[model samples]
Target: MQVTIHEQLVDVVLFIGARRRAAEAKGRHEEVKLWRYVWLLDDFVRVTGQVYRFEDSLRRELSAERPSISTHLGDHEGTLAQPVMDLLLETLDETPEPEQKQHVRVLIALVNFLAETGQLDEADGFVVNRWDYAPVAIAHFSNPEEAQAWMKSVAEPPSPVRILIGDEYFQFWYMREDNTRGMYRDYPIEPDLEWLTARGIPPETPSFATRVEAEAWLKSHPAHPYTFVAIAGEHYFAVHHPWLKRHSLHHVASTLEAWEERKRLVELDTDQETEDPSEGAGE
Candidate 1:
């Protein structure tokens, strides 16, 4: 009887569980951490329904069908184990590199693990709800007033959940362990230019030193938000519009850092715009 790919996956999960347990029992903390974090096997187990059904029959089948794979996992000697999938595929000589890549991608999709930022995307975030403690979905509101109203009402007492608001700016309500609730908002302060940079604008790049100047530039160069840098107080901000024709002073930072960081942050949300046209054009 040929073992199906899904069955092979199930066997791998079973083998990983046994290996993880053996590592824990023997005080092999690093190996256990590898199985939990690097391979993300617990998430795999959960998604595969193995969390609820770690059947002895399946373990026995895994051991019998792929003894080499099983030995690699079950080895109590702890001779630097490899990821279960990698070991299984290598031993079977069945899945080619491309197919293995697809399988790995499928595995990741099944687990739904948040990779780096721990957020689904730019517009969505995860927070623990008071009642269930599972990740609750949160998103940005269109405007500040609605966000403020929601913060006071839906995000406060009697609500079973907390919400995180804003993309460039963030505001959220949280309850302390002591049961006190409070709101936290991160608002940008005025940036001071004198202490930050005696460095004048980059020779020719257009600099908007005031809101009126910035607004006028936005009106004329409707599509060129990334071309101009805005200077307010001591900081420089990357001026942008989430939508075309709408202007915003993105996160403010001290001169040099402001120029670099704000530009990078906005780039995450947008593609690179054309090079600043006035480049080399001396102010």
Candidate 2:
């Protein structure tokens, strides 16, 4: 049976820690430092805090510009990364530093291997929170079909909505209880406009029956790299975005009279720019 990437990571970290302890006991100070360097490299890839100083020193010594590590890992499926890590584990003891005396060379070699094989961007093996771009899971599943089935089981149905594609941004408009309109502006995801146009779906005509149906159609057709948004019965829930589909619908309160109040409250709660409509909107 296969293990999740998280489990593999636990195993690797434990192995490194044990090796460090062994080196310390044998008075192999140089080997201990090397193992500690590898340990810190692992930490650096996970997060940049505290490790930044070590990374900065390594960066200078390497005398090469490296891409900044994203807060979240990228190889969501771990298909490419698992092999490299497994090989690294196999060779950890035999891999030796050069006469130049750099402790981070082992990690540098791993990085170079990734870059050479067009696998650098796929270094991470986890899902992430879209809102915060933070890693949330090791992997949804090794298999795409399994992951999709899991997602479908828990995904909140996409709210019925109409899209208003604008010059620079778009809006998701829905009818309110008072028959007035409510909209979320500049939603992160964009609809496949060309696909819609081909099917004669204007910003006004041919609203999606359901978000799920829309996604199915889009997935089958895939005219462009875009998605849709909609409002729920009373609340504007943040759903449909990748990584957010299976999670709880983020509650966003917006009403005609309460628009400004909601905006104020939201601004106070988070530094994120308010996405609701202007005060007295749809009045």
Candidate 3:
């Protein structure tokens, strides 16, 4: 069994897009929202606030160099980002300032719900991340089958969790009538992440269609450093890229392949120990 975890960068982009949308749709809580979840280094992440900060910081950091805010913040000036920007500014005035860190997380959760519901940019690194490098969005799965299942699900039922990291970042979210649902809670388990505890969900299994399909999807994401941790007799893999396949974390075969190679080294070492009289002579 294997699963892929999304990178922190994707969340960063989503946060900005959410803020831009929130600002544009002032007094309209239904448009887009911020999601709060603890991110790397245990830093509590508030989507809108962080985006605002990231934008300000980037602008300030590169003020002398004149780096466009669009480069780091987002494409707020042009047709691509103008609408989102408008919404963000409009909503910012009314949006509650986080009284505490926990409050921020709940807000970010609501923002993600909006993103899932098609109110904001469809889940992707480009529109959400604010990069025009390519029209790219990461669609990853721990197993290749899950990726295919997700693609099918996206076209059909539309799985609620879209590559967002579970556990610390996001938890069970409930969508309101207007599709506003950015709220956060500590996870007993998040979306599809049930295998977290030994007693919770079962271990990850390779359910993707084929290895070729898996490779193709993985090849699509920008960064592709994959790691899998075996839990409850199952393996969970996290991805840095967006285009992950169903069984991206099905690396039991990978582990076996490594072990097989290591056995050869052990045999060679034994042969050398037995045959090398010069080494023994010195001893």
Best by TM-score: 1
True-structure lDDT of candidate 1: 0.41
The total of clashing pairs for model 3 equals 44
lDDT score at residue 189, model 2, on the 0-100 scale: 25
lDDT (0-100) at residue 182 of candidate 2? 34
Worst 10 residues of 3 by lDDT: 35-44
In the predicted model 1, the residue pairs found to clash are 191-233, 191-234, 192-234, 193-233, 193-234, 204-281
What is the per-residue lDDT of model 3 for residues 1-283, given as tens digits with 9 covering 90 to 100? 3211123335444554555465466754434332211121012122222332223333343223211223322322232233433343444444465322222233233333333333233223333343322111223334445544444433222213333232122221222223333323222212223233324433443334544544455455322243334534444443343333222333444434444565688799999888957766866
Better of 2 and 3 by lDDT: 2
Task: Write the number of the candidate with greater lDDT, choosing between 1 and 3.
Answer: 1
Question: 32-111, model 1: which lDDT tens digit per residue?
Answer: 76555424433323322232132323443334333322332333222222443354344236445654433443333222
Of the two candidates 1 and 3, the one with more favorable TM-score, higher being better, is 1
| Per-residue lDDT over 41-117 for candidate 2, one digit per residue giving the tens place of the 0 to 100 score | 45434432212223344444346433223222244233333343433444443556442122224344434434444
Which model scores highest in lDDT? 1
Worst 10 residues of 2 by lDDT: 158-167
State each model's CA lDDT, in order.
Answer: 0.41, 0.38, 0.35
Tell me the TM-score of model 2.
Answer: 0.24
Q: Would you estimate the TM-scores of all the predictions? A: 0.27, 0.24, 0.24
